[model samples]
Target chain A: AQSVTQPDIHITVSEGASLELRCNYSYGATPYLFWYVQSPGQGLQLLLKYFSGDTLVQGIKGFEAEFKRSQSSFNLRKPSVHWSDAAEYFCAVGGGGFGNEKLTFGTGTRLTIIP
Target chain B: EAGVAQSPRYKIIEKRQSVAFWCNPISGHATLYWYQQILGQGPKLLIQFQNNGVVDDSQLPKDRFSAERLKGVDSTLKIQPAKLEDSAVYLCASSRAGGQADTQYFGPGTRLTVL
Candidate 1:
């Protein structure tokens, strides 16, 4: 089974400060990792994805993530966060499981940005 | 391209009442998924369909929940005798189902409040 764990339930960061959200996954084989953001009353939007080649992947909204196989982590990072960046972020792992397109998601981390 | 679409963005129903939610995937998307997201939790897969065929439905509660994608384009999820625990956001997502890392686009989600 593929599962994701997000240790931080809530995080508060000041505007213009750097941010990092931790994510850990358990899967038997190589896993497909994804970062998604959800604002109030909106659906989730894909920020980035990591499949095979690169350990570091860039995503929309000036965000980036690095896949560390040794640690079984794919952490999302941003050089600076804006007030509008306040939202819930989720990490998901898919593939290499019972079903082809099934995804296992983490509990999510709610981000709060203050000026 | 337009993103996934869902109907009845908000619903308030009493316990033991029935409610249904609808979803329409992107034009060419072959895979559709229904997920239940409880407050402060991540979205959990309830069911999945691939071109009108069931791909995975391991987590769906068969006793109270039922879903169908009759023509493989539009889908519906229904809950009979709703419970207080059923109050959550029902998210619908779709993917092209092309490869290992296919990204799933999400709808705005229908927030159900069980009174």
Candidate 2:
């Protein structure tokens, strides 16, 4: 089965500082990767997705992620984070087959933006 | 466009009680999904439907959980004789189609607390 791993359970970053969240996946084939963010008491919002084409993908809210096939990683990055960026982030992997294309997500990383 | 809609922003129930959640997907979406998110973990898909038909329910706890999308536009998820471990956030999502690359848009989840 395809699985995602996010090593960091919690990450604290100062406002205006750069941010990076690590994500790794285990899949036999080329996997479709996604990053999602969830504020407290809210449902998830897609940050970005990588299916094919360039390894780097830009998403809404000034976020980006790079899919590194050799490392089995799809890490999310932000050049500068704002206080509003504090949220729980999830990494997910998909692309198995037609009916089996549901996503498998990592545990997630809770981001805390310090002033 | 308007995002997915889920009802009963929060629900509290005791063990062995029954509870249900309602979801209305974005207009024109053909795929609906139900996910359960335990505290500190990412959302895990429980069931998926495509145009009023079940596409996947392999991860759903069929013994106690049931879900349906009758008209292919709205969906309902029910838990009978809920257990303590059932305390989690139930999220509903929809996509244009049940394909490998389709992006699923989420709704504000229904938080369930099983006492």
The numbered model that scores best in lDDT is 2
| Model 1 CA deviation exceeding 4 Å by range | A97-99
The model with the greatest TM-score is: 2
The best candidate by DockQ is 2
Q: Judge candidate 2 against the unseen true structure and give its global Cα lDDT, from 0 to 1.
A: 0.95
TM-score of chain B of each: 0.97, 0.98
Q: What is the Å distance of residue A4 in model 2 from its true position?
A: 0.6
DockQ of each: 0.67, 0.84
Candidate 1 chain B least-lDDT 10 residues: B95-104
**Residues A1-115, model 2: lDDT tens digits:** 8999999999999999999999999999999999999998888999999999999999999999999999999999999999999999999999768866789999999999999
Task: Look at candidate 1 and give me any clashing residue pairs.
Answer: none
- What lDDT is reached at residue B25 by model 2? 98
